[model samples]
Target: MDALWEGFQEAVRLIVRGDAGLREVAWRTIVVSGSATLLAMAAGVPTGYGLARGRFPGRTLVLSAVNTGMGMPPVVVGLIVWLFLVRSGPLGDLELIYTKRAMVVAQFLIAVPLVIGFTAAAVQALPAELPDLLAALGAGRLRTLWLLAREAQLGILAAVMAGFGGVISEVGASMTVGGNIQGDTRVLTTAIVTETSRGENANAMALGIVLLVMAFAVNLLLTAVQQRRRR
Candidate 1:
């Protein structure tokens, strides 16, 4: 109880004072997670649309794999990324291990499956005759995709929320691949973990508060957009 209250106070102080390190961690959290979310959306949205519409062979197997990936452990994702990027690994010649780039990659892998799953579900929910109607109305592939996407913006925004939320809040993969180096790869989630590891419970909680606020703020913006679209 006392610890939580102390953490609340510390959180207020950190925010009011605009602590440099805290700000840095917060900003990096946004950059890395935001980048990952955007990349996931870019890659996953189209693929999901295809899955929902296409009739190619092995599609069921692919969707099943994506569904499995949606629930895969973040730490395992981190370990896989680490293995691929680590020195002496196949792609290690690029030397991206233990960097912000690596963190972004890990988070992207963590978020993409969720994006795909959500997008597929959302796209599949639309009227089955809608595609044929659009095609009959002379909408080409890209144009049809755009129109369908606008119609399904709500789910896409939901995917945005889920993707950003997933990456921003995940500590395991970020710490594992990012190495949590101060001023470089350290993000809010990893910072909280660092504080807790050293027994700084109050600071950990304070950082958690900051993380929640950040996530809430981003979600609020997306929700506002979603609701406006709904109206």
Candidate 2:
């Protein structure tokens, strides 16, 4: 309990003093996780929409794969990415291992399925004739998709939050693929792990507190926007 109190004090002190290292870690966390979420949103939204609307051969197989991915262990995701990007492995000549890029890739893979699943569910819950109605109103493909998206914006926002949350909070994959290199690949979650392992309980707890606050802030902003849109 004392340790936790000290940690909170330390965290406040760090924040009030504008600690450089903490700022960097926080920024990097946003950049990496934000990039992953954006990429996932771009790819997953369309893929999910297609899944919900189009019927083709092997569609079930693809959905099953996405469903499985949504629940797969983060460590396993890291290992799979590590193998493909490791030295002597195929496509590893780019030397991306243990870098922020690698972490982003791993995180993107982790978040995409959640985005896809949520997006498909959201779109599926919409009226079946939405597309037809839009077309009847002289809406082209792009316009129709746009309108449908507006109607389903709430669910899409939920997908965004889920994807962002999943990647931002995961340490296993980030540590595995990123090597947790200080000033390079260390994120909030990994930083907390490192501090705790080194017996820096106050520092670890401070980082944990920062992480929770960051996550909550982001979600709060998203929720505000979501609610505003509904009105």
- Candidate 1 lDDT over residue span 1-231, tens digit each: 988999999999999999998999999999999999999999999988889889999999999999999888899999999999999888899899999999999999999999998999999999999989999999998898999999989998998898898899998999899999998999999999899999999999999999999999999999999999999
What is the Cα-based lDDT of residue 5 in candidate 1? 96
lDDT of each: 0.93, 0.93
In model 1, residue pairs whose N, Cα or C atoms come closer than 3 Å (at least 3 residues apart or on different chains), thus clashing, are none
TM-score on alpha carbons, each prediction: 0.98, 0.98
Model 2 Cα shift for residue 95 (angstroms): 0.5
Please state every model's RMSD to the true fold in angstroms: 0.8, 0.9
